[model samples]
Target chain A: MSELVDCRGLSCPEPVMLARQALQETGNGTVQVVVSNAVALDNVTRAANQMGWQVSVEEEGEEFKLSIKK
Target chain B: MRDRLSIIFAGAVVGLLAVILVLQGNPANMGFCVACFIRDIAGGLGLHRAGVVQFLRPEIIGLVLGAFVTALYVREFKSTGGSSPLMRFLLGMLMMTGALIFLGCPLRMILRLAGGDWNALVALPGYVLGVWFGTLFLKKGFTLGRSQVQTAVNGYAGPFIAAVLLILLVTAPAFIFFSEEGPGSMAAPLFLTLGAGLLVGILAQRTRLCTMGAIRDLILFKDYHLFLGFAAIFVVALVGNLFTGQFIPGFEDQPVAHVSSLWNFLGMTVVGFAAVLAGGCPMRQLILTGEGQSDALLTVFGMGTGAAFMHNFGLAGSPAGVSPAGQWIAIISLALLFIIGISNVNLHRKAKTKDYSKAS
Candidate 1:
């Protein structure tokens, strides 16, 4: 099962940080990180990629849900 | 896609909030200003001895606390420091000095323009030029170096200090300064200001909304992602100002604003250059400090102390016009920033070339 990290209404490094934590907890599995802003979306995506995770992003209303798999 | 929409939404929300705060009795065309608020806070702490500009602004306190709480809740709090702390401190001081000379920061520069203050038109281009100048150094590999992770307590200091300030604000201690009747004396209700600050803090934290970064990114990487957010704020605020009847075209007799276009341009140029060198705007520094970046905390402290010095030494501009001292300081700051930028870039390049030759 994929773990979810919701970072709605949060800012910048927070979303990236949360996504990182979720990825660590899930190890090699998939982790879904949801963020509300473009900056956070970009940051989280970059962080996930840096950690050697495959990243795919989906738009959900005014928020982004990124699915990362190691 | 979703992220872009969110930036727009955040911009609209912030625009609306700024208008609401102005209508609710904050300073005209002054709803959310980091540098001005920090100056006021310095006065409140008796750092500057400025009688009229003294006030313990709750919004600033709430901003730090809000970011701190959110960072803690999300488990993203990391205490770190040791990345050119002294340089960061000096940059912060220079940044604040320039901001005071212009009577606003980057955010207020935009807000001033949205409210029809034509003075900002001059400052805006100067700001871009300054950022562009800084980007030249950035391309040359100018860096403050990497930060080292430290104990959690290091991250909590800014928040703890903010909490204490909130308490002081609430208690109204006799020693703590409060404005008698000036820009500082005029404020919205405490709860409303705090709410606005908290909201902005949360949104800014989420969106990484930085005016300097917006310009820097656009210049360096041709990225408009963050720039869109600022554009949204300008458009939305323009509409809001129109509705609030705050749109007074032309620059004459603008509240708390002067008419010297040359100084306006130079002042913000100082701000833009220093802010770019420091890696963020004043608001961004405050947010980072809340998130446990000790370097940012020092920067904020530097800003506060610089504000005090600006006021005490008559280096800050006034409604009449830019002070003589302020004008001199702006020139000196630009020259100093240029020296810092050039020297740092050369040192880094030499170091890199040395390492490359050794490896070969």
Candidate 2:
């Protein structure tokens, strides 16, 4: 099962940090990170990419959901 | 959709945060200002003998420390330096000089506007114009070169220094100065301020929220992503101020502000230009320094020194108006920034032409 990390109301580094944590703890599975801002979206994407994860993004209303898969 | 929501959310959160700080007694309409707080910090360190503005701000220290901790935990801490450190320092100093003349940085400018200070309305356009002008040079291929990766110790230095400063603030040593009165003497509770700083630092580092970058990107790339976030701050803050009975709109007699419209505009113009040249706003520079960018650390120090110079030499304006010396400094700084922009652009162009000639 994919793990979920919701960082919608949080700002930059928090979302990025949460996303990183989700990725790290989940090890090899899929991790879904939800964020609300462009900065968070961009940073989370960059962090996921750096860890060699394939990422897919979805727009949910005003929030973003990033699915990172190993 | 998500990007838009995130920007707005970030903006609203910051706005609300600023209002809360103000309500909690962090100076009227002067909540969460990086430049002003840094200036106060400079005074605290006895970098300047300015009695009225001396205080070790926990927010500044917390910002650096917060960013440092987050960067380390995420393994994004890469110590780097040697990217025109002196130039960055000069740009930072110039940036601070401009901000002090205007009595606030870009963040405070927006906060002031949110709190219904019309003077900020004037300064805003000047800031935008300055950033637009800087973008012209950027399009012409102006660059600050690249930074090389350094050792871990180098990366840790900024955060280490910040940590030490936090200790000094806590210890209240006799040598370190503290404001007995004035804006320097005013602040929210220490723990609250530190927490606010850490929270802002983390969020800013993650999202790369920068007021100057918001303007630069909007002008250059027609990108509204970052702009939307900052705009949200204004909107949210305005609403919060209205609700809290803090909204007072007019041109004159605003708290901690002057009615000198021309200087306010020109002063921020200098800031806008220097921030662009330095590749980030003051807040962004602090975040970068925390993330182990040595060049940015130098810029932060330059800002501190610039603040000291402003107060010590009476180049900083008050609610009364800009001093004659401050006016002269603003004019000179503007000229210096333009020179730096033009020369950098021309030098790059010349280098490109030389390379082409060699190829031919």
Candidate 3:
């Protein structure tokens, strides 16, 4: 099962930082991260990638869906 | 005491802005709004193409050159470097985006209401609330970081750019950009506009005048030194409008304004918070750029880019009301600001670790 962390509407590093913390808290297989901005999505993906997690980014309107798997 | 020279300096600045508006045939109610004028310039340069609002206002160009000349005279001109410049640039963009959405900067909101634009009434409170929150963050120690002195080349950079713009203003290049039929299209004569800009530029530089700083200082330190200048602008503008028969009372159909109170308030709230964080309003930023502060220049560029985005995305307000897109951006922007504020604050520290270290 994938846990979701919705960070839509948060600006800049916050979205990515929150996703990292959530991932760490879950300490597990898969996590879904969502953000309202393209910049934030890129940050999330970059942060996830650094942690050696597999990630996919999907766009919905102005928001992004990032599915990360460990 | 001559230290009180700020009052006379600010008064002179107000008087200079008045002359520019009167000479330009702008709604006498309006004068020297960096945000509004820049919006008009964007419209003029065909950036946005918003009709009835395109004009290559000479006052803006004058502001830069004016400060440029004064900086040269006072020997206060020194170029400098800023840390996190790109981030500051982006912050400026967001700042402008928020200001345009509300149809005024913090300075113009007061001007708008002082000129009897009731829509501005809504914005005043929001501005206060936003500044209050910013002050809270400041109390908790949020800062963008310090600027370092740089090579003389950096100080001359903005002056060089301003000189080029001045050249463009004078030469009227055959390929010069201008709006065909928008607020950008409306304009006052070159000399009159520039003269006004120069006068205010000198006066502002002398006094360290800033509308946003005026209010911020008052709230943060209970200081009135700067607020006096702001109060003077309102008093002078109100009187000038009354004398010129420019004071029209109404929420609807006000020049360069909209009627949505909630968005108006929210828009300026964003501007106020951003201005506080950024350290000055648009006009103050211009002055700083003239003095060779590259960070302020970045902020100005950010504001210009933000204006472009606001127009392109239909996120700017009209006389009728705020755009739905603008409202969405406002909501998202506020949340983003909150997150930035909270996370960057560095609140939780092992007792011995010290939060002041982050601050210092």
Candidate 4:
């Protein structure tokens, strides 16, 4: 099953780091990350892109949904 | 090591400071104010000759020795430097100048408000606003560049200076400045003050306590390690102050403070910006200096030299109010910060372009 990681209220490099760490630990899985700020969302997207993971972002008001697959 | 342990350490340090302040007759929020006390020390050493505020504070000595001892114990003491040290020194100067104009460091400003000094309330928002702008610059890719590892002697320079200052404080040398009256004179006893400073330094070192870093971390990376420490300090200090009967509520005529709301806010705005730019609060900078961060050391010297210039040029504010010269310095400093941001952004853009070209 795909895992969801809600990183809302988390700041830069954190959501990114958390997502990466989770993906590594989970070892090839789908993950969804929620970020409260544009910067964090952008950072997560960048990290996902860099890691060659499939990513889709959903905007829900002030929050963002970043889904990634490895 | 658990992160919770760091918070406990910070709480203990705040507790120790409360005890010290209670013993010394300082108001509850009066513990561990590097900027305020240094101003007093400046007057005590006859630097500004501000009457009624002269006192040779033991806290500064304590902070240096405490951090130095802890760093030694942890084997983290590595002296290195040779970065743009002089520039750091100048920034430190601007930092102190701005802080004095505001009448407190970020920690003290928060502490002051927690103790019910509404004057600090005015400064707090300005600080956050300044940090916000700094964050924008950071988002735009502004950086101070990298600091290369230097010989151990470079780090020694700061401690050596601190040691000499301590000796001068004790000796009351003619060349060294002192204030005859003002907030400088109203100081806690020597040993107790130093003890409080040492405890703060040790805890701060262990926990990486920094008020500015706390705000910045929350703003930048949502890292709570530093902010938690800040919260602990405030909570502990608030309780300590209340128990000690040092909690005086009101904005008008708080001890060692002024009431110019606009300048108060703007002053901290400058401090907040500089602190974020420099990567730590004044106390953090001092601890880093002790721990062999040459850049931090340079910032300390910058503060001291800034103090000298502030007093010499009549730029330091008083309970009376901010000087025109002080106002001008703040404006110029802000302008310079903007210029630095622009250059750093341009450089980052260039780097990104080159990297992209190579990758393609």
Cα deviation at B244, candidate 4, in Å, is 2.3
Q: Model 4: residues >4 Å from true position, as ranges? A: A1-70, B15-19, B41-48, B51-56, B174-178, B346-360
Sort the candidates on lDDT, descending order: 2, 1, 3, 4
lDDT leader = 2
Off by over 4 Å in 3: A1-70, B346-360
Identify the leading candidate in terms of TM-score: 1
The collision pairs in model 2 are: A12-B203, A12-B207, A13-B206, A36-B6, A37-B6, A62-B2
Candidate 1 vs candidate 3, TM-score winner: 1
Using lDDT as the measure, name the better of candidate 2 and candidate 3. Answer: 2
Q: What is the TM-score of each candidate against the true structure?
A: 0.83, 0.82, 0.77, 0.77
- Model 1 ranges off by over 4 Å: A1-41, A44-70, B346-360
Share of the reference A-B contacts seen in candidate 2: 0.02
Candidate 1: what lDDT?
Answer: 0.81
Model 1, B1-360: lDDT tens digits are 776787777777777877888888778878878899999999999998878889888878877888878777765566878878898899999999889988999988888899999998989998998898888887675767656667888889999999899899999999999998988898999899999888877777777778898898788656677788889888888999998799898889887789888889998999999988887889889888877888889999989988999999998988899877788999998999998887666332321011121122
Model 2 chain A lDDT-worst window of ten: A8-17
Tens digits of lDDT, candidate 3, A17-43: 567676777676877776654445655
Q: Which CAPRI tier for candidate 1?
A: incorrect
Q: Which lDDT tens digits does candidate 3 get at residues B1-360?
A: 353466556754674476356546654445767887777666656677456666666777777777878877876665665645876687687778778878877767767766888888888888888878777776564656445667888777776776776676677675556666545655666676777878777777666677776777678656566678877777777777677666778888888787788888889888888777777788888887877778878888788778888888888887767767789998887776676666556454111111221122
